[model samples]
Each structure stands twice: as structure tokens, then as C-alpha cells.
Target: MVYIDKEKLKEIYPPNFRLDGDIQKGYINEDGTIEGVFTLDGFEPCTLDGMEGLWNEEKRLFIPNEVAEQGAKSLVGAPILAPTPKIENIREFFEKRYSMLDCYFENDESVYNLSTDEDVLKKYEDSKTSFVFLSIDMVKSTELSLKLPLELNSIFDNLFLNEIASIIRGMGGYVYKSVGDELIAFFEPANLLNKVDDSILCSDYIRVFILDYLNKFLEKNNLPQVGFRTSINYGEVYVKNVGDKLELNGYNLSATIKLQNFAKDNEIILGSNVVNIANKKWKSRMKKLKVNPRKLKKEGLHEGMKVYRLHNLEGRYD
Candidate 1:
């Protein structure tokens, strides 16, 4: 949430400045002459930069813009909503779900089962391609979906997906799939090292963008805030087209999802393979995460294998 100094704004809004300080109207713009300064408590006063008409749907009120999110809402100052399922609960949650997630790890060759539709059968070719996979799971989305009307839920989901996809593409990654409450993307192997770095970097951008920017924007509007977890892994996968969409199957992809499941809200988990290939700066930020050996092997990961998390984030998983 943010506030403006009504007295000060009244001084600025007049014949010199035509618009008022109403954020709901989304009308306010000025160089140095006339401006409505927004202050997020405990942070320095700042302004949202852009032409007028901020309420325009394109402005995306919640999250507003990069300038709006970062300007007044500092990453450290943004109100982080830590709902139910604390760190200990996250550990217990994954431990209990091992049985449910076994299918992803049961087979060494993680090939996608061909779709039954006859028309797209030929598109399911045997060719395999290497990709650095990134998975981001929105936390508590199911609860929000159940509570919100269907159309409203979709609006929120699309808001998230569209913003997230922009971040991924900005880092030169391709969005492979977006399932309910989960976003899966791929970076090509043509430039493996850089792609791995790109995949790892996505988490950082997303962390601040969601927690500091989007969530704050939503909170200001009196809407529910959301959180997410991300995982990155690198490997080869069989790629096929099913109804104009790319479907991928690979052991590493499953491993990515498994790692994401274990991550806490606002957390980024890295598979050992991703760490091995990631640049030194990114690797330096990670603290090894321990997991049950039996469950690790069941997820196509081996005993004594390493999983990593950004050590700076608050969590007991390390």
C-alpha cells in the first residue's frame, strides 16, 4: 500500500497541473513542476514514472510498472506475506508427498507418453534436444482459485503468467508450458553455459518482481497477494508438438519439478547439475539443501547429491 500527501498535492494540482492526486483515476504526471509523491511507509518518498492514464488496464495497477514497483517499494522494504506452511511445514509437506510424486522419478528415461490423438501422432518424433529447464510454482494458488470466481481467477492467473513470461523472455528463455499455477520454460542448448546462467538469473528477477512489485501492487488495491517458488535444471529432453504446443519429456525436467515442490515461497532451489554449470557469482549465493536419500533417488536424483538454495533468503532448509 502507498499514500500521497494530500496537502502537498493540492498545492501542485491546479491551473499549472491539470490532474488530481487520485490513484484510482490513475491520472498524475509531471517533470519537476507538478507531481504527487507516493510514500510507502518506512521508505523514501518516490514517484511512478510514465505518461498519464495509469489506470488503463495496460498499466496493470497491481504491480503497475517496473518503475512503480521498484521506485517506492524497495525489495527489502516490501511487505512479504508469509502465510501458512512455515519452513518446517514445507519440509513435512514434501516428505508426505513423496508417494504422490513417485511417478516423475520412477523411470530413468523421462519420455512424454504420446498423446492418443491420431492427427498429432506424427509430430511426436523421437528426436531429443537439450534444454535448461526452469520451473516456477505459484504458492497457494489452488486456495485462491477456489475462493475466487472462475473469471476473476483467470484474470489473476493471466496477470501472473503474462508478467512472468515477459521476464523469462527478457532473459532469452522460451516459455515451454504454463499449467495451472505452474510456469515451465526452457533455454536452448545452443549456448548452454549462458542459458544456465539465464535460467538461474530468472529466479532473482522474479523474486523481487513478484514480492516487491506485483504483490505490493495487489495489496494496495485490497486484493490477495501471491508468492512463488522456482527451480532450475539442465538436460536433454524429447520434444514434440501436441496441438500447436511444445511438449517436453526428460528426466531432468522431472527433477526440476521435484526441486520446485521442496522450495518455500519466495525461494529458489537449484539442482546440482544447474549449480555445476551456473556461473561463479550465482553459485556463490547458494547454500546446499539436504534431502532424504530415499526420496532423492526416487526423484531420479542420487544419494549424496546436492540441492542448493539462495542462502540470503530466510529459510531453514539449508
Candidate 2:
């Protein structure tokens, strides 16, 4: 059975970081002490070896075992892990090989089990991964829906699921979640520097492709035009498997959704985290705008809370 060195972990995290819940079978020593337990938050049952710490109950921010030991009040005073690691290649491998629904089912088998099997649940444990979160929403969706007939709505939906989503996947990104006309995607860049570049390339490609191709498809079928806006931020998130499917949720994901509201129609807006890792080449494609510094004070980004608007995808190398 897999086990954690409880004493070592505690020493790193301090008194408040207590282990709760039942210890897994066979991990209890003859002394009746349980040193390790299964996690519902990692890609594999043994992936904690790569993580330095855990998030608190509120899921506000990651608390490194070392910082917790130092009596750090929260992640603000402590140094949280910046970009989450792309620990597994599951999405990148399967997305191109299968349809979105098929890919989701292949990775999230816990949803198919009819019995309450511990092994099945264990097989579905989520992995904590670092990724770039990109949220795309159709601009004036309600108004557009009202104007379109049922056939046109169907056409638009097909364009998103087939065309737009495929473009993202082709660029080594995943359209992990969606609601109505909005899509929430995650891109696992190899390193911090690649996060902004990857997101920019995908977003720019989607924008240009839709403007060029989608319009032609609509014209051929005698339909109206549509526009969209994309917002992106990068950080750690839990890719969890529940009853019917996998879900991506965490502090960073939530923040990205909120950031999406700040984007104007047909524009791609980036958060501070993306801006921080962006190089001169990536930054050149965008124009930086300042946010209300006072509004960002609580999030530890007040010093320079800026968002960048994409100017054009032209001249981008990759």
C-alpha cells in the first residue's frame, strides 16, 4: 500500500495540518498507527510524491508543507507553487485520436461503474496539474440566439463543438468544460514561459479561423455572423472525476471565469499571471491595460494588476 511519512509531512506542515478520515487498509502498522492514505486529488494514487503541499479546506491557495511549518498564516505570506506541473499526457494523447465525448469517457471511467467499489473510485482519483485556463464566450449570445432560427442555432453549436474545439485540440489544448455557449479550456504548457505563448497561439488561431472560415460556412448556408471573446489565466487546478465525468475546479479556475467578464467582444484578454510569464514576443501581440489597483489588493496582485488585450495574431511565430 502507498503511504506518506506522517511525521515528516507533519513536521513540514505543522500542528494545524492534521490528517483526517480513515486510513486505507494495510497502511496501518503493527503499532496501530496509519502513516499513509489514498488521495482523491491526484492523477495516480502515488502522485503526492511530486506535490510539495496541499490546499486548505477553502481551496484558496496551495500551502507548502515547509511554509505551513513556519506558521505562515496563509498562502499570501507564503510562496505558493506558481504554474502547476503538467504531470500526465492523458489529454494531449487522446484528444486527437477520439471525439471529445469519447475522450472524456475514456479518461473518466469512474462514471461508468455501477457498484460502489473502492478500487473503481481509487482508479478515478484526480491529478493536481498546472495549466493555462482559457475561457471563451460567444458575445451577445442571448441576442444572437433570439435572432437565429433553430437551424442556425444548430449550425452554430456544430461549429463550436466541431470546428472551434478542434482547433484548440489541434494546438495541444483541451476544451475540458463548457456551459451553454461558453467553453472552459486548459492547456498544459511544458514550462512557465510557454504558458502565455501557447494560450496566445490557440486564442489567436481560434479568432482568425472563425472570422475566415466560419463566415464562409455561414454564408454558404445563409446564416448570420457571430463573434466571441476569450479570457486566459494560468495556475494549478484539480482535474477531478465524479459520477458522470471529470471536472476542473479550484481557486485559479474560478478566478479565470471572473476575469473573463472583463474582456470586450472579439478581444482576447489575459490576466496578470499570464502577463508575468509572457516574453517580449508574446507581449508584443497584446496591449496592456491597468485594472483598479485597489480592487486587486485582496488577491495579492494590487502592485500591478494589469490585463492585456490582444492586438493581432499576425507576425506570431508560434
Candidate 3:
């Protein structure tokens, strides 16, 4: 059974009283009394005193199936007088919950299941396409980590990671993994080749966005500035569905790592493929902004070698 994030549920019932037990175990009866066996901290069926204080007609409760499976209570109650939760907030809650559980949250479980099947693999063997991989690493992460106090460091990490993930999602990219001070993302060639021009445009916009966002956040918090070196690569990568998880295998991964290593201080480097689509005009713009752009030599790149650079900015990327 799936579990909803408790924090998200709290947001939905902002001002209402929440029963403290696992919500899935309880359910509401037709008459409005909680009927199941679930434990409720502030509710007492014997007295019905708490019931009097609860909103009657507009009340709603969220119950997970696990609680019900445990033979817990049924009629957990919550007033619905609060505003409806935003879709984005709901998405974030689920994402955070799954991340905390160290589980992959499939947007479409059915698709994942079907794609991973042996029969499906035989049918779509040749039809499967590859993806481009990109990694963004925080520069001097150890130094930056040391500069911030423990409490502040935790706050900064949470804020920065979420911001970066949101940006990638907004740009139609998938975040493969988010490690200590870095995140890896992927772009499917099938989705990108159609609008190659748009993809290039989006990439540049996102890089600038990250730089600006970090700068502003640091300035506002009066924290030491932090910068990032990003490496992006394109190649034929095998994307496979493993149960509920998606995995990528190919040179793109290694290429992105190599590009990251090649990135100079406050500079962005582009692979031949990326430069072909982006053109020298974009490089000139970076120069005018005092951002240097370098081309990686063939010897410096590998089979999946792509583009990379360090972000230098005066303010945060909005």
C-alpha cells in the first residue's frame, strides 16, 4: 500500500485537527463517526466531545490502505475548512516521502511494469533509444560545507537540492540521482532531437538560471558564495526499466564525468555536438558576460564526451 507524506496531509488540513495514528487504518462512516480500529490520539468515541468541535458538513479525511489492512479504525475525521492543497505541493510531498524511503517513485507504474517485462523487451529491442547524461557538481563543496554552520548547512542543502531538481523537472529533464553536492540528469534523444534548437536554448537558459539563483540565495542569507561545474554529454545510451526503477547504461555517463574534470574555473565547455547546435554566437555572448567557453579536444573527450562548464554569476538564477 502507498503512504502519503504526513507533512503534505498536514498542509491539506492546515487548520484542522489531525488524528495522530496511521491514517490508512481508519475510515469515516456514513454518519460521520470514525468507525475503524485505528488509534486516534485526540479522538474518543466514547465521549464524542472532540466531535463537537470538529467541522461537520465540510469535513474530509485521508486514509491510507495500510492502516486499513492492519484492521485499524475506519472513521478518522478532519475538517475541510482549509484551502485545497496545490498540485505542486502535493507532488513535492510524494517526492519527498519516496526519497526518504529510498524508493523510486514511478510517475507511471503501469508503463514501467510493461516496459520491464521480458516480452516487452523482445518487442521493443530495436525501438529503444538513448539519452544524454549531464552532471552538475558544486565546486569546492568541502570548503563551502565547512563555511556554513551545521544547522545552516542542512538548510542550504535542502533548499539548493530542491531548487535544482525543480528546475530540471520544469525543463522536462529527469533527475537520475542527487548525491551529496551533485545531481545527475538525463535527456532522451527521442524527445530532444525533434526540437534540437529548443533543447539547446533550454540548456543555456537553465545554466544561467542556476548561476543567478545561487548568487541571490547566498547574498540573501549572507552565506559564502558557492558555484557549480556542470558537464553535459550526448550518446547512444541503453535505457532499461528495472522493476519500478529506470537505469541508463552507456558512454554518456563516463563522458559527463570527463567533461566535469575538464571544466576550468568559472568557465563552460561545449562538446562538438553541443557547439554545432549552439553555434559560436552563444560562446561570444558568454565572453561578453565575462564567462569563458572552451572546446574540448578529441583527446580530452571520450566516446560519450559532451559539454561542460563552471557557473560564475553575480546573482541567483531566477
Candidate 4:
């Protein structure tokens, strides 16, 4: 189990600085605690051994352990282990491969669970937030659905969609909406720098998973490989609650969707705003996507709108 040592953080960072980057993306339970990692300065992000309180997976934010217990008791024996469906293998993968990540999954069926809970929806109710939005969809879903049995297709969809959703949740992003093989997720607004960094990191991790693990699994099973197209953007969006649901309306979201549509399979794209505000080192790693000016639409896009892709994937960065 790990928690944040805020005093150490306060000393290193200024009074105005805040970081809530969740790497382990795990949760602390009533019986025990899960590990997590939070970032801090430069490439030297402070590793979060854990949070001081309960790591609410549904809310994707830390909450008081007392309140967590109350909510857990209210659920009649269901300990609020972030309710993000912590799968054991997923947890093991992070523990072995990425030391900077905090993941708390140890259960199944939690992959598809997301922001529908009251606790999550309440915070964003009738509010405007500046967040990093990421959109992705499987490239081969349509073709697979056409050629394969519905049952087999559904299984494949679930496998691919749930894996990506798990990564989003683990990276401290929220998966509020997933349709078929497509997903729309966002990083929290409290700390945009780490969030943007996390967004790019999340995309790279997904790509690596496709290139390494998923592809191997598909090959072993004699199944075709698949990949996703990802696009990320940043801006303020209004979260309006209607009939106990969240409706996010904004140009950022729309443009992110458009950017995803323009991405090639297995590609990760970033909007201009994200490129402009990203850490300087990361900015150096990205290159603008070339396209016919007439093909790219201006609606819901920034002036001199440009899309970007990571030019360096030769190795993990320091």
C-alpha cells in the first residue's frame, strides 16, 4: 500500500503547484491498501506509494477514507475498491513493467464500469472543466463484425475495448463513455501538465501493448491483429447533468473526435493546444501531421489548426 507524502511535495513545489497524477491507478481498501504512483518534477515524477485516503476508482480521485467507508457500508458489504474492476493480471502487468504507475485492480467485470455512479457525476454536475480529452476506436471492428460470428465479434470487442479502458483508468483518466469498440475518455483538470504528459504516456503504452503483448496473443491464437486510432485535445467543457447523466459539450471534444477520425490505425494524434502546452521535451518529440488543407476542416478547431504525432518511439524517455 502507498500514500502521498504531501509535506515532501510541498517543500519541493511552490504553494500554487498541485499534482494528482495517479500511476498505479490502484485503490486502497478497508481491509488492505493498493499501490499507486503520482508524479512531481521533470521526468522525475514523485512515485506515489499510495494516497493518504481511499483511491476512488469510479470518481478517479482520492477521497477521505471515512467517507469511503460510509459509501462502502451503504453498499452492504461492497468495499469501495474504486469500483473500477481491478483485474489481477492487469495489476501484475503494471507492477512488473511500469514502476511509475499505481493500479488497484483485482477483480473482473470492473473494466466496463465507469463514470455513471452518483459520486463521480456529482462533482462535475453543472460545471465547466478544462481537461485533456482522448478519443479512440478499434480499426478492425467493422471488418471483424462483418466476417465473424456475432458472439465471436462481441468477445473480441469486449477484449479489445476492456483492455484499452483498463489502461485509461490505470493512467488516471476517466472512461465515461464507450460505444461498441470506441471509447471517449479524459484526464482530470486539477493538474494539466501531468495530465497532458499522462495522455501521451497513455497513448504510447497502448501502442506498446498492441505491438508487444496483444499481437503476441493474437499470433498464438491464430487470430488477426488489431489496433486503435487515438486523438487527444485539451479545453474547457461544460458538464451539464440532465436526468442524472453527464452531457459534455464543447469544441475540444468535437475536435478530438474529428482528429481521431483523421488518424491512421495504430496511430496517436494530438491537437494543437495539447502540442502548445505540452512539456518542452515532449514538444521536441512531436512532429506535425501533414495533410491536404482542404481535407482538414476548420470547424471546432483552433486557427492554424495542426495535428501532431510522436516522432520518437525508439525508446522510453528519461
Q: Highest lDDT: give the candidate number.
A: 4
- The alpha-carbon lDDT assigned to residue 260 of candidate 4 equals 78
lDDT for each residue of candidate 2 in 102-130, tens digit (9 for 90 to 100):
32324543222112223322343587767
* Candidate 1 residue pairs that clash: none
- Give the lowest summed-lDDT range of ten residues in model 1: 77-86
In model 4, the worst 10-residue window by lDDT is 98-107
Please provide, for model 1 over 162-203, each residue's C-alpha lDDT reduced to its tens digit, 9 standing for 90 to 100.
Answer: 567656765667676678878887776654555676677666
**Better candidate number, 1 or 4, judged by lDDT:** 4
Model 1: runs farther than 4 Å from truth? 1-125, 241-245, 298-300, 313-318
TM-score of 1: 0.57
List lDDT for all candidates, in order.
0.59, 0.56, 0.46, 0.63
Show where candidate 2 strays beyond 4 Å. Answer: 1-124, 293-304, 315-318
Give the per-residue lDDT of model 4 (tens digit) for 160-220: 7667766777777878687778888888766556678778877777777766776666677
Instruction: Rate residue 169 of model 2 by lDDT.
Output: 60
Alpha-carbon RMSD to native, per candidate: 19.5, 15.0, 20.4, 12.9
lDDT at 178, model 3: 70
Question: How many collisions per candidate?
Answer: 0, 4, 25, 23
lDDT of 1 at 209: 68
